[model samples]
Target: MIEQRDVVIIGGGHNGLTAAAYLAQAGLDVQVLERLDVLGGAAISAEAFAGVDARLSRYSYLVSLLPQRIIDDLGLSIELAPRRYSSYTPVPGGDTGLLVDNHDPMATAESFGALDAEDDVVAWAQFYEGTQHLARALFPTVTDPLLTRSEARAAVGDDRLWDALIEQPVGRTIADTFSNDLVRGVVYTDALIGTFAPNDDATLLANRCFLYHVIGGGTGDWNVPVGGMGAVSGELERAARLAGATLTTGAEVVALTTEKTVRWVDATGVEHETSAEHVLVNCSPHELARLLAAGDAGPASTADGAAAPPAEGAQVKVNLLLSRLPRLRDERVDPAAAFGGTFHINETFSQLQRAYDEAAAGQVPGVIPAEIYCHSLTDPSILGPELRASGAHTLTVFALHVPDRLLTEANNEAMRATLQRAVLDSLNSVLAEPIESLLLTDANGQPCVETKTTRDLEHVLRLPGGSIFHGDLAWPWAEDDEPLDTPARRWGVDTGMPGVLLCGSGARRGGAVSGIAGHNAAMAVLESR
Candidate 1:
């Protein structure tokens, strides 16, 4: 028998759940189908290693892009705790490191002054001041309808800020502003996170990544979720259920048609057909193209008749269960304060470019430039009593420039082992003790340094090409030829098919843990009605 629903969400990830919650709140009957037995998708937590007794944010760690407005509207109980520090980067062969203390600017300035980049202290503040203004004018527009580029310029209200961030390359801005190599890397990291773009490149891909990273909640601070990343999706799931939405796990949608008919199989392998008035997709754009193949409809082409930008993920996620924090090679900084925020290793400006050059030449960086964060330092709620009492911690290391092309099916395991060794070696270079010595052993006595290579993410999370942003991030403003009047087209959530919309990171202004895509998708459905 064919079932009827007002809305059918294709995936049960956080974005999908967000869309379902909003639509159901609007009095629409929404049903969400998830392929996995559990929800949250990549934004999930797990007792990854045996005998660890710790809930690790297996993937998609931390939160920033999720706005408070979405929380209040959904009446969610998710809490994002601010970190005392923003970032700490160890200087080579030095007792001091660059620490950006969130609560103490004097200390941060002192750190910058030690670097002999005294001018950067002022430049750093001015840079963020511009971003703050940009965020004020732009962040609110994310959930609202999209604006043309000219309208966006007017909204930002600062020609110099817009020209530096939007018109010119982010690398140029960083290079011209910051003189120190380390400081340049720190500022440029915002643009390069999860992106494969080089610093000297002219592409605006890095600019889009930078804009999104800095514009989170208008302050651009990435906060730690109090109870692992699962807490985020859990709240969204709760909101959806409270609003009378139906969510089914282990129900993978296998087929779809342009008429809003979806065919999926449940855990029992029993296939069912359902029809909805509207369908919201929370998967990658490529995945959506495959789902709609039966209907002969696909994503719209750009004005230049080019296919959508290539979406290739460029990161290697290493999740470590440490028995204790490794002492820093730099004697001046405490381990807790350093690891509480992003701890950078081997990520200087030239080194980042070198890593990109190596990857471009089909080789991995010898000294992997990665960032690490310890969630337990700020919020230990994600840990069980046993792990917490033992002072065990979870360290999530995200290494950059490892594109999907490097991890082939034939050599995935071998390459992963090699990369893990390289990561440990890199960490040991900056630490007083070898990181491997502090690793927690599971019941089988296996080292608890688990790694998710680009291929692993591709297989496990279904992030096509393992791209975390789902697809290449689009510019927040309207393109030159994009329709000005079409709400769906302008908003970038429109799938271009009747009764179809996007509610995932692939959508415009979508990335990180932000629910803007889902919120926009629901708005599109409501406005259509």
Candidate 2:
């Protein structure tokens, strides 16, 4: 007999756990099925190198965008430990780094000034204000479905919001806000992170939304989870279980067996049926589509009648172990700089765009833009005895859009080495000392690039184009025109299939670790029931 449940959530990612937690809190019998042996999905920690402690890989690292509401609502107090000093952008000149103190724009500016007093004060002030305004204006829209053009205009005002939205590429936004090239480069480069778009690309304005989403407290405050991002997931799972949800890790859902409106799940070789009033999908749209296709279970047809296309986008993740903190030319810099913050290295707009172009053309960019973070510096507990004595560190490099074709080429190994070397060389160029002191150098790492590729991401998470955002955040794709709520269908949290809801980053409000999608999906499920 098929075992029955009130709700069976597919995938045990943070979003999935969040959804299950909320549903169970509301008194629903929820069971989470994860394919992996552990929870956290991409927000996971694993031992990449032997003898080293586990670290976040694939989509690893920090996230401040997780809604405060989720934290409080789930009572994740034990699981959530906020680290001080979010991130840093080290200047090439010397040991100077622009430090962000947990969303305090003023502090960030002051820190920048301390590093360089000349023109940095004025430039940082302007940047702080612009990002502050942009962050406030954009934060609400991320978790919500895009507004209609008229609604967007009304909300943002016809004159101001439209102007910024239409004309503000990263280069333009930075130029309009700051005078210093170093500050501008640091701030603007953020808009291009994880995207295939270049700094000058018009789409970068949309990318700015991403920067806004991750900034906690304010424009500059970033937080590392106490143990790594995996801790966030672990806490979410505990909260879910505490709320009466049953979590089954290593139980990969192989198929969705639906009998009319009712759905059942098949995990591994075990078959379990769940008769829930509503079903919430926390996986990527592409993954969901494939799961449904494999089961012959398609999306609810449109009013006019049509199914949505699969999600797509290519991504590559690299994790490195270091023997010591990065040695920069600027020694006067605080040793704390090694922890709790990101260090970005990109000199100009042209350099940024070339990287994107190379990735688009299926070639590794000569100059890789890296967002390097050291967890040990942020979380003292993770500083194993070996690290304390040796000052070791973990670095995750999110190289955007390396073409899949490169992997098929005979020189793929050479290409990977080249890409790795470029990132190391770039960091060394900006630092005072050679990276050799920091190199732990291990060829063996867990969760290969194949796990994060557009194809694999699509296969696993169902994100079209392997795009993590669910839908594009570009001008044409904003608000009402967003793919989540197209004229033919509504894939956002509320408007999808009556009993089906969306909680992934790709939902209406778009990407990030924020629980907006899950919260919204849960509310929708509760309200419908």
Candidate 3:
């Protein structure tokens, strides 16, 4: 006999677990089916390398935008590691550029004094104030989907908010806000994280919103979860289980059976039919389309019409296991900056744009613009004694300018080797220490290695173009205008199909690790039911 449930959640990622937790808390029987043995999905940590405990993969990283209310409501015990201010732009000569909070901003001003001192101080001050204002205005809209544009306008008032919203790209905004080019460049680079857009692109302002919204406040104070980002996912899983939600790992949902009133999902080879009052999909819209297309042809058409098909976009992520901390000329800056701290390698806006141009042209950038962060520096427990002695670190390089489709037809060995060479070469140009001293370890710590190319992420996660944000963060898609709670057919938590809801990043006000999408989706499901 087919098993039945009041609610069936497909994909046991953080969002799925969040939805399940909330639903169960509301007195519903919810079962979550996850393909992997782990529960966090991309937010998971695994000991891909032998000897090492577990590390976060493509989606591994820190999150600050998660509201305090969720933690309090769920009684989550996940503690965020203390965060330090971020440093940016390591100069080639004896000078090292830094940007930190609580410190005298003059230190950074002096570093760039030769470039343009007057411009630096004036611009940095304005940039700081503007981001502060933007954060105050944008945070509420992100946390609550019910916020209306009029409410947002009222909060910031019409003129200033509209000017910040529509006037300039993030890069330009930073430039216009500050007199210092270094400050503008450093602040503006945050907009490029997890995106394929250039700093000059107007869409980057919205991208900045994505980064800023997740920062809790706008100024880039990032915090890692205790243990690892996996901890956050683990806590969500615990919360789900405590709330009476069933989670089945290593059980992939291969297809969905849909009728006008009900849907059944097949997991792996076993067919588990479930009669649910509601079904929540935590996978990407593109993945949902393929699953529905394989089962119900009619709904497949509707899902496709809702969004574009999954295609490779221009972006790539490189995770490296290092034997020791990289040596830099500025030894004063913590080596942890290599992993948990954010650093941008692009020296100028043109260089940053060229990286995107090369990716758009289906080629790798001659000079990659990267945001490098090492998690081991933030969470020392991951480092064994040998690593701790040598200050070994695990570095995640978010490199732009890699063709989104490079993995589609490239040789795996050649691709890996090429990427390794490129990364080392980039570091050699800036770091004072030897690159060879840092040992390389594989996913299993054996002679073998593990890496996720654009194709791997696309095939496994079904992110179109390997775009993690789901869809581009353009104007109409942001703020109170966001489709999160809207009744639209194209976007929003409401899918027009009653009893069915979207909890993925593709939904309105989507992207990042905030889980607002899932929370909003669950609320929508409850209201509709």
CA error at residue 170 for candidate 3, angstroms: 2.6
lDDT of 3 by residue, 11-82 (tens): 888888888888899888998888777788777776657766445444657786666677777888877775
Highest-scoring model, lDDT: 1
Candidate 2 or 1, higher lDDT: 1
Which parts of model 2 are misplaced by more than 4 Å? Answer: 78-120, 137-162, 165-167, 203-205, 211-220, 257-268, 272-275, 297-315, 332-335, 338-340, 401-415, 441-466, 470-491
Off by more than 4 A, model 3? 53-58, 92-95, 99-106, 114-118, 178-182, 202-220, 260-268, 299-307, 311-313, 330-340, 410-413, 440-450, 474-491
Model 3: how far is 464 from its true place, Å?
Answer: 2.7
| Candidate 1 displacement at residue 502 in angstroms | 1.0
- Clashes, model 2: 27
Give the top-scoring candidate (TM-score): 1
Question: Stretches of candidate 1 above 4 Å error?
Answer: 294-310
Find the 10 residues in a row with the least total lDDT in model 3. 259-268
